[model samples]
Target: MSPLIALRAFDDSINSNSSVDGVSVVKIIEYVVIGIVVLSLLALGYMGWRHRYNLKLLGEAIAHRKEKHALAHGRRTKDVQ
Candidate 1:
Protein backbone atom coordinates (compact mmCIF):
# COMPACT_ATOMS: atom_id res chain seq x y z
CA MET A 1 0.00 0.00 0.00
CA SER A 2 1.03 3.59 -0.64
CA PRO A 3 2.09 5.78 2.27
CA LEU A 4 -0.88 8.10 1.80
CA ILE A 5 -3.32 5.19 1.95
CA ALA A 6 -1.66 3.81 5.02
CA LEU A 7 -1.83 7.20 6.72
CA ARG A 8 -5.47 7.60 5.77
CA ALA A 9 -6.26 4.19 7.18
CA PHE A 10 -4.49 5.07 10.40
CA ASP A 11 -6.46 8.29 10.64
CA ASP A 12 -9.70 6.45 10.02
CA SER A 13 -8.89 3.87 12.65
CA ILE A 14 -8.15 6.59 15.18
CA ASN A 15 -11.33 8.50 14.34
CA SER A 16 -13.38 5.32 14.56
CA ASN A 17 -12.85 5.45 18.36
CA SER A 18 -10.31 2.68 18.64
CA SER A 19 -8.66 4.70 21.39
CA VAL A 20 -8.72 5.84 24.96
CA ASP A 21 -9.45 9.51 25.80
CA GLY A 22 -9.53 10.29 22.06
CA VAL A 23 -5.87 9.35 21.74
CA SER A 24 -5.01 6.34 19.62
CA VAL A 25 -2.81 3.86 21.44
CA VAL A 26 -0.94 2.95 18.28
CA LYS A 27 -0.28 6.60 17.51
CA ILE A 28 1.02 7.18 21.03
CA ILE A 29 3.28 4.19 20.71
CA GLU A 30 4.59 5.45 17.38
CA TYR A 31 5.34 8.83 18.93
CA VAL A 32 7.10 7.18 21.86
CA VAL A 33 9.23 5.08 19.52
CA ILE A 34 10.17 8.12 17.47
CA GLY A 35 11.08 9.99 20.64
CA ILE A 36 13.34 7.18 21.80
CA VAL A 37 15.08 7.00 18.40
CA VAL A 38 15.71 10.74 18.35
CA LEU A 39 17.03 10.71 21.92
CA SER A 40 19.31 7.77 21.18
CA LEU A 41 20.77 9.45 18.10
CA LEU A 42 21.41 12.62 20.09
CA ALA A 43 23.11 10.64 22.86
CA LEU A 44 25.29 8.74 20.37
CA GLY A 45 26.36 11.96 18.69
CA TYR A 46 27.24 13.54 22.04
CA MET A 47 29.30 10.52 23.07
CA GLY A 48 31.17 10.49 19.77
CA TRP A 49 32.01 14.18 20.09
CA ARG A 50 33.08 13.75 23.71
CA HIS A 51 35.26 10.78 22.84
CA ARG A 52 37.04 12.73 20.11
CA TYR A 53 37.65 15.65 22.48
CA ASN A 54 39.01 13.39 25.21
CA LEU A 55 41.34 11.66 22.76
CA LYS A 56 42.69 15.04 21.62
CA LEU A 57 43.35 16.09 25.22
CA LEU A 58 45.02 12.78 25.99
CA GLY A 59 47.35 13.06 22.98
CA GLU A 60 48.35 16.55 23.97
CA ALA A 61 49.07 15.46 27.57
CA ILE A 62 51.16 12.52 26.43
CA ALA A 63 53.19 14.66 24.04
CA HIS A 64 53.82 17.25 26.78
CA ARG A 65 54.90 14.60 29.29
CA LYS A 66 57.19 12.99 26.74
CA GLU A 67 58.83 16.33 25.99
CA LYS A 68 59.26 17.15 29.70
CA HIS A 69 60.79 13.79 30.44
CA ALA A 70 63.22 14.11 27.52
CA LEU A 71 64.23 17.62 28.59
CA ALA A 72 64.88 16.52 32.18
CA HIS A 73 67.18 13.77 30.87
CA GLY A 74 69.26 16.35 28.93
CA ARG A 75 68.70 14.48 25.63
CA ARG A 76 66.38 15.67 22.86
CA THR A 77 65.34 12.56 21.00
CA LYS A 78 64.00 12.61 17.45
CA ASP A 79 60.55 11.65 18.71
CA VAL A 80 60.42 14.62 21.11
CA GLN A 81 61.50 16.98 18.38
Candidate 2:
Protein backbone atom coordinates (compact mmCIF):
# COMPACT_ATOMS: atom_id res chain seq x y z
CA MET A 1 0.00 0.00 0.00
CA SER A 2 1.08 3.57 -0.59
CA PRO A 3 2.26 5.73 2.32
CA LEU A 4 -0.73 8.07 1.83
CA ILE A 5 -3.20 5.23 2.08
CA ALA A 6 -1.48 3.80 5.12
CA LEU A 7 -1.53 7.18 6.85
CA ARG A 8 -5.20 7.59 6.06
CA ALA A 9 -5.99 4.17 7.45
CA PHE A 10 -4.13 4.95 10.63
CA ASP A 11 -5.93 8.24 10.95
CA ASP A 12 -9.27 6.59 10.37
CA SER A 13 -8.48 3.91 12.95
CA ILE A 14 -7.65 6.55 15.51
CA ASN A 15 -10.88 8.49 14.88
CA SER A 16 -13.16 5.45 14.70
CA ASN A 17 -15.01 3.99 17.65
CA SER A 18 -14.68 0.33 16.67
CA SER A 19 -11.44 -1.71 16.25
CA VAL A 20 -12.02 -2.54 12.62
CA ASP A 21 -8.74 -1.15 11.26
CA GLY A 22 -6.90 -2.72 14.18
CA VAL A 23 -8.02 -6.13 12.94
CA SER A 24 -6.56 -5.40 9.52
CA VAL A 25 -3.31 -4.24 11.08
CA VAL A 26 -3.10 -7.45 13.11
CA LYS A 27 -3.83 -9.55 10.01
CA ILE A 28 -1.09 -7.71 8.08
CA ILE A 29 1.43 -8.36 10.85
CA GLU A 30 0.40 -12.02 10.98
CA TYR A 31 0.89 -12.45 7.27
CA VAL A 32 4.28 -10.75 7.42
CA VAL A 33 5.47 -13.05 10.20
CA ILE A 34 4.24 -16.15 8.39
CA GLY A 35 5.99 -15.05 5.19
CA ILE A 36 9.25 -14.49 7.01
CA VAL A 37 9.08 -17.95 8.57
CA VAL A 38 8.40 -19.62 5.22
CA LEU A 39 11.26 -17.78 3.54
CA SER A 40 13.69 -18.68 6.29
CA LEU A 41 12.72 -22.33 6.08
CA LEU A 42 13.27 -22.38 2.34
CA ALA A 43 16.66 -20.70 2.71
CA LEU A 44 17.79 -23.17 5.34
CA GLY A 45 16.67 -26.10 3.20
CA TYR A 46 18.62 -24.77 0.21
CA MET A 47 21.72 -24.24 2.30
CA GLY A 48 21.53 -27.77 3.62
CA TRP A 49 21.16 -29.16 0.10
CA ARG A 50 24.18 -27.18 -1.08
CA HIS A 51 26.27 -28.33 1.87
CA ARG A 52 25.52 -31.98 1.15
CA TYR A 53 26.31 -31.59 -2.55
CA ASN A 54 29.63 -29.93 -1.75
CA LEU A 55 30.54 -32.70 0.70
CA LYS A 56 29.88 -35.37 -1.94
CA LEU A 57 32.16 -33.53 -4.38
CA LEU A 58 34.89 -33.24 -1.78
CA GLY A 59 34.75 -36.95 -1.08
CA GLU A 60 35.09 -37.79 -4.75
CA ALA A 61 38.05 -35.41 -5.14
CA ILE A 62 39.84 -36.94 -2.18
CA ALA A 63 39.34 -40.46 -3.55
CA HIS A 64 40.65 -39.41 -6.95
CA ARG A 65 43.74 -37.86 -5.39
CA LYS A 66 44.47 -40.98 -3.36
CA GLU A 67 44.07 -43.18 -6.44
CA LYS A 68 46.43 -40.93 -8.39
CA HIS A 69 49.00 -41.08 -5.59
CA ALA A 70 48.86 -44.85 -5.41
CA LEU A 71 49.26 -45.19 -9.19
CA ALA A 72 52.29 -42.90 -9.10
CA HIS A 73 53.89 -45.21 -6.50
CA GLY A 74 53.46 -48.27 -8.83
CA ARG A 75 50.61 -49.78 -6.77
CA ARG A 76 47.61 -51.41 -8.40
CA THR A 77 44.31 -49.62 -7.94
CA LYS A 78 42.78 -52.38 -5.83
CA ASP A 79 46.03 -53.21 -4.01
CA VAL A 80 46.62 -49.78 -2.54
CA GLN A 81 46.51 -49.95 1.30
Would you list the clashing residue pairs of candidate 1? none
Residue 70 alpha-carbon offset, candidate 2, angstroms = 0.5
**Per-residue lDDT of candidate 1, residues 1-81 (tens digit):** 964457557777655667778877667766787799899999999999999999999999998898889889997755533
What are the models' TM-scores? 0.71, 0.67
Q: Which ten residues in a row have the lowest lDDT in candidate 2?
A: 15-24
C-alpha lDDT values of all predictions: 0.79, 0.75
Clashes of each: 0, 0
Candidate 2 residue-wise lDDT, 1-81, digit = tens: 965466557756663543465555444555677799899999999999999999999999999998889889987577536
The superposed Cα distance between candidate 1 and the true structure at residue 54, in angstroms, equals 0.7
**RMSD of model 2, in Å?**
6.6
- Candidate 1 regions with alpha-carbon error over 4 angstroms: 1-16, 76-81
